[model samples]
Target: MGAATPSAQGPRILGSRGSGSSPATGPEAPGSPLTASPGGRMGLPGAEILVGLVAGIDVNMPCLGFALVAKDLEAARDVLRVCERLGIELSEPFYTRKGLCVTAVVELPWYENPVHFLRRRVEGYLRYMLPDVRRVRRVWGRLVWKRVRLPAAEADVLMPLVERLLREYGMPGLKLPATVAEDLEELVYEWGRRWRRSYDWAFKVATGRIFRAVSRLSRRHVVLVKLEDLRGIKRKEKWVPVIRRWPWTRLLRLTLGCTPPWVGVALVNPRGTSSDCPACGGELKEHSYRELVCESCGRKWHRDAAGAANVAFAKPVEYLRFPASSPMNPKKPGGGEDGGNEETQRTSRLVDKDPQPRAPRDGSRPVAGVEHTRQRGPIEGLTLTRPQTLPPGFPASKG
Candidate 1:
């Protein structure tokens, strides 16, 4: 590996040593299409792409961090460092295994549930159709259910009102029933089911946009994602339902479903991708909001990008079950219930042979410059009014 040479600015660019050549011409260089795409006519065969999934800063906000890097571990670190210093996007097109100039054209805010609208209409319809029924109590912003029950005669009279409500709030292209059912409760439940199904469809469409952009980038390489089960994650010594805070599993399923048959999907252990330094396998300490510094190498990295790069090369500790022989199934042939894929497993074995640097050869500590010395910790009580966008080069997400 080469040593980092800093320009007049703070970020270091990988020169001709650690990477075997300058990144501009190197085979694993992310900037070069010849090497970056990997496995096409000009790319090296059997290369894998990395993606780091970071949850959003706020619980109410529907966003996740998707930083990426696809190159030599050292080179990826350098590129990520450069991106931070230059104020460029955190994820490069190369990390996505997509060619340069690929663009995402999908519309955003994939899921828009009409359950709330239906709830509101039901309240009004009850007042107009059955004056005897009064909302005697409100629980957590919803009208008490027993008060809204209707007699069979009232249900029949409300059929026309229910039909009009469905027409008003129903999504376009959805098939409407020939006539409203005699049971108002059944009709309400049916509308809820229809909306839920439509939500799943919209989620697929949003993910499809991301896949189309990735496919346009490159047609050859498989996308390897580092997924961690964060449903039971702990925060500040308190148990929190992280999945309810954000749809972590939903995003994973959407990614698997949208991927084309030609491209492969592999799930790797997310364990230390964000905490370990990709360059030296050293532990990383938080340096700032969403940034990290390697304790051993003393280099700064954007948390998301460094994690994504490490994911590309991280080994899977356990078998991740998915559909067999599908593009989303990363399991090797004949591995059956326990087999692992070749790309990440092979790379981890190769990396083990190299001597991991425990300390910088230069006999200097990581520069405690103004940038590195800042306070490092999580933001508390942060909230956003609107969904945040993914780092440039991918789809605009509002999941």
Candidate 2:
């Protein structure tokens, strides 16, 4: 009876903060991780859904947004719709002016983890880099006025130690998360001009971190990023949302591509993501398909995909690995429904099981680990690219 009481009260006790020291947690620590990988995704009728959604962020800020493309048209549309809806919900807080004061937690439903990451990011390694560069500039730029660019060399020397300290000096067994990868990628934008090597190193580090993050999740991750501008959007509205102008998907892909061949990394088509309502099969007629209006049900939803389309299903696979007790993932090593191990392995290796390098190189920069430099994929269903070499101490990405 006594033991049961303590056990019963255990949850409450822990919740009360009277326990021993706990790991530091940010605003997103308590939300479900299901919102990040496949669990956060929506399903299309038949085609394989890539980036089923693209959500805009911070309406108050300059219109920087994200896109989800799967390289496949039908699949991309499904992903885009979800992203569009999420973008509106998130932007609402800012629109109502509530987000300015941290009045409510609006991001927990879909992208909780990313929201938390943005909060924790203010104190990352990036903060230290620029100030150091500035201090050096304050003294150096004055000493040599336009004779030669010496700050680059000086920055190289002063920066590496700080970078090393950040990566190595942390407590043993503490692993950085994918959010830090975003921070590292952002560092490139801030410092890339002054220190090119540092930017490269930061990008390399971010890719490695993201590779590990994408790997641990289920193998069916289809990385949907904005690829190309299919057509110019004709907006009739007096004012367009700021995010419509942002290329959120592009930044995500370029950063992850620094390492190459990450599983689930691909460009998803942005058409039809949010044109027709997933709830109702009605054509959306409002704000260039930005806002989805289901005339049949009258339930309106904000659309996010760049364009429109239809879909169909493919065969399922065998030998699937599901969660330990998840209903879908059987504990037993059951055979796949259609093709057996060979076919399953091939598809899984490209996504859920393998690393998808970002879409094929445009022949501008050389892709590392690509044996035969013949580049003709991305459009014709090539998801896995060559893996790049990782620096020492960086974990090798799983195939």
Candidate 3:
């Protein structure tokens, strides 16, 4: 742990929510055209590009918008036809100056307490020694090695110099043990990136969100599919004020403008992608560890995969009917004649819950207070839309 993300000093564009909120809804009609979707304003008719809106979060892997390849407008849906490897999974959750920033946890460290302490001590010193907010702000904002964060950068610059200066002072015990030195360095750099991104997510009224979405979409030439916010699904998930304020769809368009002129953005109404079963129209049973057990057919599904599938392949029927006989929705608790409910929970990505620290991705508790890193990598999920032209102003012209 290099430095914990401090909401006050870091960024906080949006807020966070509780669990089991909106649980999940099923997918819409398979291959149906999506017009005026919530995620983004771009209209995806389902034939032009291989668009797979992200629906849920995997305990092990976080996903963002997934991609598939397609040249013309009438491409076929190949579930496996994705970009090199990208999707719309959020980063680790942290409060930003403006709102919530969702990032992924690439690595975890055990010394969270120490890292936080270091961050506070150093930041305090910076604030005091360098009284000017502008200068202190500059140091904190500068990317570490143009890659990592503050503590990581500071550690790299200071550790050796401090050790050298103190070599004759008999303070050898202050040096970080060689065993944890390597891991600590990596952790700091990573935290720097993660912590700063929280601010980036909310900075400039969501300029960072737009930049990230567009950059990723442009690089892959993939269509940016916007899904509804998952907040509206259930009351259990406390409504996040910042989430309501953030214009994710607008960010998608801004990202589109930044993309190569050819890459496109699209939207999909991701209603009921989480609750209804795709294998059969059966009500899905919520499972621990983020899975859905189909009550009608007794099939088990990973929550993220199922939700992504629904995002991509839900039915054409505008209205969804809950099984009247099911115990969870007995008498169709949220169902009606045309759809389940008029005020149905039409929320967005199950990319997942609160801003709090998450358990290890593998679902195992830390044994002896030690957590092992997973060996897996991010998934190359469904989509296809490659950029034909590089955006303008690449490799800034040297005078």
Question: Any runs in candidate 2 off by more than 4 Å, and if so which?
Answer: 1-216, 219-249, 252-255, 258-262, 287-290, 305-399
TM-score of each: 0.34, 0.24, 0.29
Tell me how candidate 2 scores on lDDT.
Answer: 0.32
Q: Which candidate is the best by TM-score?
A: 1
When 1 and 2 are scored with TM-score, the better candidate is 1
| CA lDDT scores, all candidates in order | 0.41, 0.32, 0.37
Write model 2 residue lDDT over 1-399, tens digit each, in one string.
122332222112112333333343531134422111122121121212223222111111112222222333443344434434433222211111111100111211121222222223333553554445344543543332211111221233334443454355441122223344345545534443433343334434433433332232213333322222222432444434333433344344453453223222222334454455433456666744345566775755444321211111111111011112111112214323223455455544555633544543554543667643345546575466655776789886686
Better of 2 and 3 by lDDT: 3
Best model number under lDDT: 1
Cα error of candidate 3 at position 132, Å = 28
Worst 10 residues of 1 by lDDT: 52-61
Colliding residue pairs in candidate 1: 1-17, 1-18, 2-17, 2-18, 98-217, 99-217
**Per-residue alpha-carbon lDDT of candidate 1 for residues 204-259, written as tens digits (9 for 90 to 100):** 55555445444422222233333443444433464332222244567666655655
Ranking by lDDT: 1, 3, 2
Model 3 lDDT per residue over 1-399, tens place = 233333212111122222112322222244434332332222234423343222111111122222222233222122122221333333222232212223221212122333353465444443342234233444543423222123453454444443443353333333433333344456556666774454334333323333444344333233333333333433345643233323344434444454444333233456677787655668888887666799987877656555644453432222111111211121345432223544322321122243224467658665654545554665466344556775787554343
Ranking by TM-score: 1, 3, 2
